[model samples]
Target: RRKAGWVKERLDWFEQMSQLAVDREYVSGETFLYLGRQYRLKIVYGSKRSPVKLRGKFFEVNLSQSMPEQDRREAVRRAMWRWYRAHAWEKIRKIVEHYSARLGIEPPEFRIKYQAKRWGSCSQGSVLNINLRIIMAPLSQIEYVVAHELCHLKYKDHSAAFWDLLRLVMPNYEVRKENLRRSGWQYLL
Candidate 1:
């Protein structure tokens, strides 16, 4: 009975993952997030290699009409990755600089990471790793994560002092933490 239950649970988890993958399939007019704002995709068939740009309220995708449907999807995916990576690099660096001096800790070596369990982590070597998906989050939430990880530089563990430091840096950190936990499901894609 225990073995059967375990197998059933595994199957259910796989099914949910598959469903989420399908749901994330990109299509024209579908909304995608950036800095907590949703921009609807506008596919405009065109001739350039550069295919994605944020124009006003729309994330316009310029593509070649001759491209196959499958190829177009792949192009969009690649374009999105490029967009996220470029923005994340700039945003994360600025946040680290802003908080490092305020917290009285030298800024750690920050880099983008694709970790499954954490939005950010601080290493013993003073290196900070931020999950790239966080680029999609609101600026406040991104600051909260950066503050929380920087706090770890002073306090290695999630001790009371760590929370105190986090609170000092971000007064409403608890709210951001809670919101981050709830919205994390969306980043699985």
Candidate 2:
């Protein structure tokens, strides 16, 4: 009877703690909501307290305390997208110029936008369209995407030659590509 009572008491305590955790709101100022137990603001993770600043090379996350009335977390996410558009364009342009010269091909027009399923795309006209969300990724991942698209200028399809070209520029292209795929969804939220 004593052991049973102890188990029941422990179960009740656990339930109460779980409910408290669920009710806790991690709102910070007016721009961000700190999700998860820990508080951190990186290019990949969005939070209410994240400083409205861009990190190294790639990755921009919004840290705002006000404006949108929606979930504070969503507001921070939207701000991150805006930051990406405003800042990432120039960096991408420079990368395209560098790769185009190396490949000896006319540089294609580049555009960045919010894309759902793709990190980047190359049209028949050789115009390269990259997802602005990539601005939230690591710089190496961004470079991998750029190199992948640039290779398309040589081979329209993902042929063996295409992989070879990508490898020539980025020896660890495969690893970076996998990382991008695995963590890309973190930016979406």
Q: How do the predictions measure up, each by TM-score?
A: 0.82, 0.61
lDDT (10s digit) by residue, model 1, range 59-152: 8888888889878877887777777888889999999989998898777899897786789998878899999989888898899989889998
For model 2, name the residue pairs that clash. Answer: 30-65, 30-66, 31-64, 31-65, 31-66, 32-48, 33-48
Summing lDDT over every window of 10 consecutive residues in candidate 1, give the lowest-scoring window. Answer: 16-25
Please list the residue runs of candidate 1 whose C-alpha ends up more than 4 Å from where it truly belongs after superposition: 1-23, 47-49
What does candidate 2 score on TM?
A: 0.61
CA-only RMSD, every prediction: 5.0, 12.2
**Global lDDT of model 1:** 0.82
lDDT per residue for candidate 2 within 1-189, as digits (tens), equals: 869987996787567545544422323422221111112444334365444563433234544434455666565556655655766797788778777777778778889988867899999988899988676677777888888899998899999999998888788999999887655545532
Task: Look at candidate 1 and give me any clashing residue pairs.
Answer: none
